[model samples]
Target: MATVKFNPKDILYHYCSTEAFHSIVTTHSIRLSSMSLSNDSMEGKMVEEALARLAECDKCDQGTISLLQAQFEVYLKDVDGFGFCLSKKRELLSQWRAYASDATGVAIGFSRDYLELLREEYLRQRDPFLGFTIAEVMYDPEDHEKQVRPLYQQIKHAIDEGDLLEAKKHSPLRSWSNDTETQRKKSCLASLGFSTLMATLAFAFVLKSEAFKEEDELRLLALINRGEIKKLGFDVKSNSLRPYREYELKKFDQCTPVIKEVILGPKHRSPISVVEDFLRCNGFGYVHVSRSAVPYQ
Candidate 1:
């Protein structure tokens, strides 16, 4: 989890079925769905377990680790998250099979600058605690510790100085009741600074199972309290209603397209001109479209 630098010019690819692609172009939006309802049962919690194991390996103080662990549990109980996924690799085989429709799916390449800027601007007018981030997914469990160490140290240092309670007292969480704050002095709402908690949550959502490494994903993630439900929608998947939010990154006749390129899947039947025409009609004529080079059926 060393600092991975990505240029603003980097391209992140979103893969989807032809029907999903049509809906994307028609609606000019991407969906950020809830992680709680994800296909992978061990979504955010896998990283939590990894972080705990790493903490023990570092031989952190039993009291401090236990306290922080308890706080993490309580703090996360009320937390919910949403994510929009993209990949560092374009036209990837596994990505095609898992996310995109076999051969009929397509990949849209977006400007990293455009996507990040959109989130920043959108958050300016929203709550700061939304904890929104565009991040690379970490597959190695051993690397999970790097993402949480600084925050862990911050709490540990406060405990060593016997000022953990003092610091917690000063950092009053508006959501916490007076009695609750007093009882849970070392909890995230008390001892952990907002930045520390926000950073931890961001990494938690991105540190997924290594089994999914082939996806080479870069996710646009948001960790929010279940209270601030705004513009959220639900779709029926697997006979259950899953929550999602539409992120509007493009619009017809908008200033410019955030999409830089579109790669048609290997089995795409439409001619190049027809695809280009579709872009032109939708005000994204500038986006370059090419068929994927994969030799897949």
Candidate 2:
């Protein structure tokens, strides 16, 4: 049986199209070429000949090839115009340091845009039962708080219209006036109280309101951010939520004593900081952290 070998040019050509690759490398029994692979081997000579062809290709760039070899890693497969594949490729592309000013900016902006889309998709699919669904906390400050005001106004409008769900949708964006770490978290916890309470009292409440307690839920979220629990734990790969919840709750409990002594007292701790300090003191170690808290209004 004859074994076909890969052409380096083929690899380069497929890569340049800015698309997923369709070619597959078959792993069959290795057949030695009529040429031996040794330096003196015909197999080696033939492979070298193929590589020379690729090096001399007029369309190829040594600079681009070197950049790819040094920095880029690809996961190519046969999928065309597929959103998931495109997104995955874009994520891989984001790690590269783009040097051209226009290209660099576009690359950075696209990475952020794709990341937000993924986050929104996850949140939509998870249908989280706890935490702030408010608008202020979610708005990006890179846009200079312009996004938050409109979102907060929408929440206000929703409140006036008696649209609780609509209000929940805008609640996470409420961190605009929150200028300190403590304030932002306290505000988030305070807001969650209404979100949880309304859900419990008005709706059927199949999900336990107790599990949605401000402290507990915040701890779980903190653990997730810290990578103590799988970040995707909320996505529920397992049928039972109890195990993941219990695991996070246990970690949270371990931090409680430190939280009470080291964080809950003076120095005006932010809610997020309190959680972080508590976690850090309880074996996670020191983490440099900062967050915006709302000044006293």
Which candidate has the highest TM-score of all?
1
What lDDT tens digits, residue by residue, belong to model 2 across residues 120-233?
Answer: 433454543322121111112222223222322333333344343332334444633434744544454345344432322111111112322221110011111112332222
TM-scores of the models, in the given order? 0.75, 0.15
- Alpha carbon lDDT at 117, candidate 1: 70
Consecutive 10-residue window with the lowest summed lDDT within model 2: 12-21
Point out the worst 10-residue segment of candidate 1 by lDDT: 1-10
Q: How large is the C-alpha RMSD of every model relative to the true structure?
A: 6.4, 30.2
lDDT of 1 by residue, 5-122 (tens): 4443588899888887887787877888888778778777754575567568878667656666655655566776788889989768888877777778889888786776777666
Prediction 1 global C-alpha lDDT: 0.73
For this target, which candidate reaches the highest lDDT against the unseen true structure?
A: 1
Itemize residue pairs with steric clashes in candidate 1. none
lDDT of each: 0.73, 0.23
